[model samples]
Target chain A: MELVVFSLLNGVLYGLLLFMLSSGLTLIFSMMGVLNFAHASLFMLGAYLAYQIGRYTGFWPGLVLAPLIVGLLGAAIERWGLRTVHRFGHVAELLFTFGLALLIEEVVQLIWGRAPVPYTVPSSLDFAAFTLFGTTYPAYKVFMVLISIGMFGLLGLVLTKTRIGLIIQAALTHPDMVAALGHNVPRVFMLVFGVGSALAGLAGVIGGFALVTSPTMARTLGPIVFVVIVVGGLGSLTGAFVASLLIGIVQTFAVAIDFSLIDLLARFGVTVTRADTFYDLWRIKLAQLAPVLPYFMLVLMLIMRPRGLMGTRET
Target chain B: MPIIRRALLGVALTLAALPAAAQDSIKIGYIDPLSGAFANVGELGVHHFQFAMDRINAKGGVLGKKLELVPLDSKANPQDTQIALKKVIDDGIRFVLQGNGSNVAHAIVDTLSKHNEREPAKAVLFLNYAAVDPALTNDKCSFWHFRFDADADMKMEALTNYMAKQQGIKKVYLINQDYSFGKAVAAAAQAMMKQKRADVQIVGDELHPLGKVQDFSPYVAKIKASGADSVITGNWGNDLSLLVKAAKDAGLNVDWYTYYAGGLSTPAAIGQAGKDRVKQITEWHSNVEAAALDEELDAYKKKYNEDFYFLRTRNLMEMLVKAFEQAKSADPVKVGIALEGMKHQTPTGEVYMRADNHQLIQPLFVSTMSAGMKRDVENTGLGFKTDGRIEAKDTETPTTCKMKRPSA
Candidate 1:
């Protein structure tokens, strides 16, 4: 009972964190038809920047300032870097982002060195928020959930109800027409890209302490973020949200399961021994493969639906 | 035409100086991950080696020649280790040092075993300082390899013996990184615990991907549900720090028996939460009852501005130099023979190289993490306090290594 309840809570929290990053990615993909390979790198930069700023002015100031800095940097990249390569088609933009990711990683290493920094949860929220079934849920985790949900609500409001959000949505489908009507389509793209990056940066500030802030942070979480967006759907925010929650919950619960194929087979009359041909493969538990579960879901979703859980567009 | 001539001249000069460079100092190639995920660990090993080399080189040198270190990045992968081995052999280095991963050590031993037989004159000696997989000194032991650290079985034997004496430990959980070393640690812990304390129930056994896990709360939750009073884990680096941090956050109160909890950054990461609860088994720690070693460690920290871990490196280097002096030659074959059944006195006690397996038999210390220690790890104001010590004779486990020595 504790396993079920805690797994549900932890999984939901993890899913919310993934949504924070993937929503921005989905938004950027909708605005520009390019997959930003450097999205996670920007998230890593946000963590490092927050760690730096937090060293002086405490965690709260760093929380606000780091995302703003990252957002501006994202806007600058879109203006000076991506806009110049816009005419070269999507492949060129993809390659440019790929190179940018590598460059960012190297620059981070040069600046921070190759060690896990001491980016810890702030002392203010370091205590247990509450205990459920004798297991303490950290107050920091509660803060993370609140922040992610708040951002999601605000993002949804601006996108659906605001005039700029209307222009951005119209620009996504008919950019040429939006520009014909005197709307600054390029500026809209830049705004969307900047906002998307800022969202990722916000995720990093909290996720950094939740996980670890290291040189390899980008590389480790890069694939999972991509999985979240791709399995959520290419450019669908709703799809991203559902996919993040599904993957997060599934992966977390899977870690609690110690059953293997051998166990399932043994429930029947079948018995497998060490001398079996693929004993190693047969003996692997779902718990052991929790880290790889996200990628496995990605492959299954691609083969089965391709358009993702709630995606409208097939692409 | 000028550029081409200059390039040719550079190549010829490099080729001309290569042999002369080899003659000036006996170079021991240090092969480990100096880049990628395990760079910090690899770099730490390098610092230890460099410090040891400097100390040895200060004493009028070995065989009248200063020992030079040749660092080659292996990226902590077996395939990359093989590549580094090739580079070591090609560069005419007859001694190589490696440690971080047991899989990498396996690769080195396999490559050098073949290379030693195929080219006896250029055979390289493998000095392993840390990779403690029991298989290295057992079924997979090589004539070219010498392990300085205690094997997994020996440490587990010592650790479980200590745990058995503590009447409080009724239930134990085994969690380790999913790799050769981690598996060896788990197997040894289980086997030894059963032998020592048959009444103790093994509550949980889990293996997770090495260096990939970011959150260990789920694993901690399972341990909590299992009602384990203690956890024995072989996870190192970020995995170790993150696991302890997660457990502390969740208020999961269980004694942690770890192999690498005292490693770089772990003490700082765990902070005050780990005080008096975390224990580690190692050959030496900062707070051990050895005044000379404490002075040397203090000096090392002062010089490098980093905590001086890896006392095994000092032993390895000193033994290597002793072998070089006793043999009076740089040839790996002669040194290998000299190193067999060799004895050296450490600050704590005397250690010997077992001729049967080339595994070092050293005294192992079981220490508990405590606050208000004279020496702390990673500046956490918490350090290891020695609980008990297992002598070299007690640490002995029978080896299956039928080492095939080269014909004299």
Candidate 2:
């Protein structure tokens, strides 16, 4: 019972963090038809920038400024870099972003010197929020969950109720029609890309302290973000949301299970010894394979349902 | 006519002395992760080696020649280490130093063993400073390879000995990174604890993906639910730091017995939360009460702006110089023979290279994190306080090495 409750809470928390990153990638992909491969690298930049700013102005100010700086940088990249590469086709754009990711990683290493920066949770939110079944959930985590939910609601309200959001949505499906209706379609693309990158930057500010702030941070979390988007559907924000939560919860709960193929086979009277071929494979517990489970699901999803859980269109 | 003759003789003498001056320095090839994810650790190892060499060179040099370090980037990969070894051999360096990962060490040992057998005259000796897998000294031991740091099993033997004496440690949980070294640590912890404190219950044993788990709350929640009094983990780097941070954030107040709680950025990451609760067993720490060594350590920090963590490098260099002096030769074969079963004295205690397996038998100290000490790591203001010290002989476990010696 304790495992179930905590796993759900932790899973939701992890899912929200993933959603924070995937939401921007989903927005940019839907709008530009170009997958921003440097999205995670932007997230990493936000964390490093926050750490640098936090060293001077404290966490609260750094949180506000870091994402703003990253968003502006992203906007500049869209205006100067991506706009220039637009005529070169999708592959060129992809290669450009891929090269940008490597550049960002190297530059980060150059500045931070390849060690995990000591970016920690603020002392204000470092206390326990509540105690359930003898385990005290931290206030920082609760803050993170609240922040994620608030962002999700704000994003939803913007996309549905606001004028600019409507224009952005229109630009996603019919940029020519939106342009014909006297809207600056190119400017709208820049705005969406900027906002998307800002969302990733925002995620990094909270996520960095929650995990670690290192040079390899982007590389480690990069593939998983793609997994979330792919499983959620290529160009679906709602799909990304559901997929993020599903992957998060599923991965969390998997860690609680110690069952292996060997354990399951023993119940059916099939004993496997150490000398048996692939004994190592049989003995590996679900918990040990939890990190790889998302990728495994990605492969399965590609095979079974390419459109993803709630994806409106096929990739 | 006499002036011209004298000038020609002077030119001949100058030409004759050039090669002797060129041979005045002995180069030792350093292969480790000088790039990639573990570059910091690899660089740190190089810093320690260079510092050791610099100090030795200051003291009239080793075997009448200054020790030169040739650092080659291994990237902490086995294949890259093999390439680095080949490059070192090609450069005519006879001594190789590396110690970040056991997998890389295994590759170096295997490749060097083949290279040494095929090219006996150009055989290179491997001096390991930190890679501490027990298999290196046991079943897979090599005569050419000498490890300065204590192996995982030996450290566990010392750690469990200290834990067994504590009455509060009843229900222990074991969490480690899922890899060969982690498995070895877990196995050693379990076996040693069972032998020492049979009544202590192992409430949980878990192995998570190494360096991959960003969140450790689920694992901590499990520990909290299990009502464990303490945790034994073989996790290092971010894995160890994140686990400790998560445990603190979740308000899980269990004692941590870790292998690397004091490594690199971990002290800063855990901060004051691990005060008096987290314990680590190592060959040496900063605040080991050796006055002379402490001054030397401070000098090292002043020079490099980094903590002197790898004390084994000091022992390795000192002992190697001793062997070189004793052998009266620069030949690796002679040095290898002289190093076997050789004893050396340091400020900490006496240590010896066990001839059966080229493993250094050194005293291991188990220390706890404390705040406001004379010396601190990573400038965190929190430092390690000695909890218990297991003598060199007491930490010794019988090895299974069947070493093949070269013909005398």
Candidate 3:
């Protein structure tokens, strides 16, 4: 029971981190109708920028300045880079962003070398939060939960309560209709893209310290963020949040429980040996399956409901 | 046979473009990843060999021929390595050097052996400075391939020796990357633990996909639940760094006995997260004193703007030049033959090539991460200090290689 509780808490923290990444990509997907495949690369850039900035001015300044830099660059990309490719339709834009991801990884390697930077948590939040049943929960994990929840609350307030939020919502539903009403849809798209990139950058600043900030960080998080957003439904932040937590908890609990197919077969008196057909299958444990479970869920969701859980339109 | 023979001859003709002997420089082909995830580490290796070659050239060159180090980027891919080997041989290079990945190393060893068979006149020696897969020195060992560093099993043996004497390490866990190298490490550790300390409980044995895991918190949770007092892992690169980071974040302070803690960027990234708790076994450490090694190190840092990371290169460079001089030829086959059973006292201790398998037997050092060192990499506030030293004889293990040596 203690193990279950601990795992659940850990899973929530991981899910929150996923949402921080997925929320940004979801906004771009909804507003622009073209998935920004370079979202994770932007996240990686954020981490490297934070490391560089932190080296000079410390971690707090990096937390503020890194995302601002990423946001402005993202705006430039949307305004000039993606805008040019928009002529050839959404696929071309997607492809452009995909290519941009590869380019960013190379550029990062060129600048930082092909190894992880020594980015660390600040000393203030470096200690454990509290000990439960002799297991100490890291303060950084708690900090991650707080920051993610704060971002979620802020996003909700902006979307439901602000005039720009109303404009953004209208733009998401019908960009041409919003543009017809005298609001610049293209500028709105650029703004959404910039803010989305900033969110990803923020995730990187926090997540880089939690995980590893290598050239591979973007590739590592890219597919998984897509999984969260896809399972949640396109353009639905609430759905993305729920899906992220579900996947994170399932993966965490699955890994914690080391149940093997061989052990299950033994209960039925079907002992598997090396000579047995598909013995390798029996050797696999739930822990090994954790990384693939999200993809499996995606497949299941796609087959059952192509519109996705909270998706109002085709995606 | 004509079709196959023609195909082989066509390949040979295409690759035999460069003259074998040109001027007074003996060309050595250095093949490794130069532009990829492992490029940084591979670059480090390239510098080490370059530094060694520079030293050799200063000492009146190898047999009066100035040694030239030609780098061929393998990109750390097995398929790319085969082409890189062909390219090197075609470019008139007789000695090929590589060490980043075992997969690339295996491909080179097999391809070079076949190349040597087909084109004996253009035989190239494969001097491995780093890849420590036991198979390279075991069943797959070849006449053309020679490993300067100790293999994985030998590292585990030395590691277990140190672990056996350490008190309060009652419960141990084995965690490694889910690959051939990792599997070998776990198996070796299990067998050694059973042999040395039958009472030590192996609480948890886990393997994860290499380079795929982003979050290791769940894995660390499992380790803590298992009540493991000490953790043994063979994971390298980001896998090692992330695992150590996860442990630090969770406040699971346990000793990590590792093979690749000294890998590229690991020492710097982990920094105080390890806090003297991590230890690694290698041929030598910066703290280990040897005659004139300090001077060599100073020169290396001054030349490269980095601390010298490669230790076995001392053995590799010295032995290569010695073999070249002794054989009275720049020919690889002759040098390879002379390399076998050749004895030399490296800064660490006396090292010799086992004529049976072409495995270099050198002194091994068990080092700890602690503050204040004579030398450090990346100013990580912590550096490796030698804790225990084992001579070449004690670290030697039996090999299954029945090398097919050529007649003189």
Best by DockQ: 2
Poorest stretch of ten by lDDT in candidate 1 chain A: A306-315
Residues A1-315, candidate 3: write the lDDT tens digits.
Answer: 878987898788789989988888987887667788999999999999999999999889999999999999999999999989999998898899999999999999888877778888877778889887777777888888888888878887888899999999898778789899999988998999999899889888888888878898898889999888889997777888898899889988888988899999899998889898898788988898787888899999889886677876776
For each model in turn, which proportion of the native inter-chain contacts is also found? 0.66, 0.76, 0.66
Model no. 3, DockQ? 0.69
Candidate 2, lDDT over the whole model = 0.88
Top TM-score prediction, candidate number: 2
lDDT per residue as tens, model 3, B1-408: 999999999988876755535667998889899986777888888889899998888889978889888998998899988888889988878998888888999999889888888888888899999889999989999999999989999999999998998878999999988888898999999999989988899998888888777778889999999989999999888889888988887779789999888758888778788778889998877778876698888998899767788888767988999999899998888999899999997777788999999899888889988888777766687878888888789989998998887554
| Model 1 lDDT tens row, A7-33 | 988789779888876777787886676
Error of model 3, residue B7, in angstroms: 41
Compared with the true structure, what per-residue lDDT tens digits does model 2 show for residues A1-315? 768988998899889888887788887886678888999999999999999999998899988999999999899999999999988999999999999999999999999877788888887887889988777778888888887777778887888899998998888788899999999988898888888888889889988898888888898888999999999998777788889999899998998888999999999999999999999999999998998899999999999999888777775
Worst 10 residues of 2 chain A by lDDT: A306-315
